[model samples]
Target: MKADAFPYRAPWWLPGGNAQTLWAALASRRHFGPAPRWQRSRWNTPDGDFVDVDQALHPSAPDAPLLVLFHGLEGSSASQYAVAFADFAAAHGLAYAVPHFRGCSGELNHAPRAYHSGDFAEIDWILRRFASEHPGRPLLAVGVSLGGNALMRWAGELGDAAAQQVRAIASVCSPLDLAAGGHAIGRGFNRLVYTRMFMRSMVPKALKKLEQHPGLFDREALLGARDLYEFDNLFTAPLHGFRDTADYWSRASAKPVLHRIRVPALALNARNDPFVPANSLPTAQDAGTHVTLWQPAQGGHVGFPVSHGPFGLPGHVRAMPEAVGHWLLTHL
Candidate 1:
């Protein structure tokens, strides 16, 4: 599909153009072929927990700006999006790091509380430690979907306090408005597909967490959940100490913090994204001077695939590491 044909470019409240290119790229879901080589490492957080991370070095350069990558919900180091971005980083002589959220690195986390969308503290802890260890090395971040929300929240919260070693940030397909996104996903066929996929991953983890801590979750409420909102309301919201789903969504939504972002950052979203609508984007007035909101016309969620000859590639995923790498090389 032609990127210009996307609905986001129709002079809507949310501007399009670049965002449309990103959306078309994501919707293609093109695979980048083989996975790149990476070394597995672990970092000890301030809380005495070890988070698994995959560090991939650029094939050409030994020392380069580090791109800290974050995957979407239930995505890990093995995810196609993660690997594709890592490959792009490698191609650009940019080292990348993929931090596996708790219970996502092929192993259950020691804590009962799993990772969530608004967990900025964890990213902060990781970045601080990485900076301390790497010292003067330049660092940037790129988050996908849920990971995008986390990074955005962190960037907004960091403001001037964000480490100087850090350079720029890029977020793709993030649901900035958690409440609206959640509401959208709970209706129609979208609900069926999303709920099934999410629960396939979530329910198992929830069950495991429940087994680990018997009284942690309400079994009845969990079993009765018919949608993502109901599931989060029953489990995620209560587990994190929110009043309910509304409170959790309100607090976790990144829209309230976009204007506060002080660092150079790029946010990409699709107008036709089944998960997040164009309305969820931050207004030009609301977005700080440092933030560049790229609302593409066609990328569906994190699925950006562009076929080239017999080999197609997801444009958004492919462009992400390069975009950040080039941005950091030029700006930072």
Candidate 2:
């Protein structure tokens, strides 16, 4: 069967109903293996602050086009998807770097401000710095999940400006409609599991931020928040200058910005992606002329496992990075 022919149709209840099973599988797939080697560095932001970055280079190809990778919420370069994608890029003689969002590089950010889905200024800073250092090399951007949303938003806002520097862009499993995604994730047992798991990581970060910046956030609100919406309402919204969670979600979702993208780009989504509903996808007609939407059937969220040959292939996963790398190599 052709790779694109794998069943992409999904049921309406899929995003909300199968949350636990799907997320559990994703967590297992992401955590089961040892991380690949990467060198850590610090990039000084324009604000006189610093952000940590992890770079995996193709030792033999230092002058190759650089691929800037962005991981999902609460994920860093250590994420399995990030590492695997880096490996694939390196194999293709591409140099890749994954920047750790504030507080995500195993070190807490110094300020109360944390990373958000629509924060493009930091990315702009990174790109400008890269351009200055590399001078002539092309730059490509690739992101997964939350990072995907950020990249799309930035591309949309940049419009024609992105064409001057970005050779190509690719995003996988990005939630184009954050409000819809939050609503979907809040239903039934999914709400309990996803909220619990995410909060386990987020609440600690919030608490640490509170300690660093006294009176910065509502401690009681952070502790009592039950879902991502509530958590963002109390924490992310105020810190980012948004009026509320709804406002933040509305501004952050990438659907409104897809048409503005003017560079060669690819958006891939699994029909059965547990975090994003299929209906929430940015309409194909709405995409820019340079954009390609690759919808594959079986990959659940980031799960693209395929069985090979007669013996039932176990413990194997076909991730999105392979397709992304192939497309980048062909187009860029």
Candidate 3:
């Protein structure tokens, strides 16, 4: 989508990337509508492991379009963006499901491996299963942050065949270029804030995975890791069958394969996103005809706040999801 056509405008009170991002994470929940009642289902993966998918409870006609949301790293169905989309899906009479990436649904996964930005194979099977169950119902998908990159990678890898499983897809604040994102998140304020925030949960989970499978990786190396690159080198790369962090980031990035997407897809990124540098984003020509690029001037990471509350309180973070969800629904 063209920049002018995009609907997000960062509120004056929520100026810059950091403020908007922090508010969306910490305060946006209160501004959203009623929390969605969820029914959780466990699906055993083909690999002898299982993933839990949370379906939002909403009264809608049978065979209504199913909206599958893939949450970001360490994010689940209850994430701020996921909950907001659940509200949007309910209002539009759509079926909504958020599939938790392995080990993210609360219970530690049985498998030694965990989710990553380029986990397209995992995305492929999960989406395929959803399609098989839904049958003729229209299937629409939205991926937030890391989930977005994985979903797009799945699309690009399948090319024309992706249309069979999903009608349309949208990604919000995804770091399509994994190498750039990895480097960006490793330095300065981003390293101190966002990287540590993610590592706080990630490191502990990885250590637990080691306990599940002895000698999976070096415990000292994992413990000594300070940034995403070091962490991935110790855990994410080897377990997932990559040479190292360099190999993983280069091979996992969706930007290189975006032009291969055959179905209608939207790749929305904020120019100000701290995790994803503006220079690393793909252009319209780079993404090809089937993809729509929305690089707005603001909206940090997955945070897009439109309206400030009474007396200049925190802004409401529903505009991005509403706009993106509408776009998905329109294609259906």
lDDT (10s digit) by residue, model 3, range 202-321: 999999999999999999989999999999999999989999999999999998999999999999999999899999999987899889998888998899876755665556667887
Candidate 2 at 102: error in angstroms?
A: 0.9
> Highest TM-score: which candidate?
3
lDDT of each: 0.73, 0.74, 0.90
Worst 10 residues of 2 by lDDT: 1-10
Candidate order by TM-score, decreasing, is 3, 2, 1
**Candidate 2 pairs with clashing backbones:** 7-297, 8-297
Which tens-of-lDDT digit does each residue in 202-282 have in candidate 1?
887888889988999788778878888888887888877788889988898777898888878778776668888778777
Alpha-carbon deviation at 160 in model 2, angstroms: 0.7
CA-RMSD of model 3: 1.2
Counting only residues 3 or more apart in sequence or on different chains, how many pairs clash (N, Cα, C under 3 Å) in candidate 2? 2
Worst 10-residue stretch by lDDT in candidate 3?
Answer: 1-10
Residue-pair clashes, model 1:
20
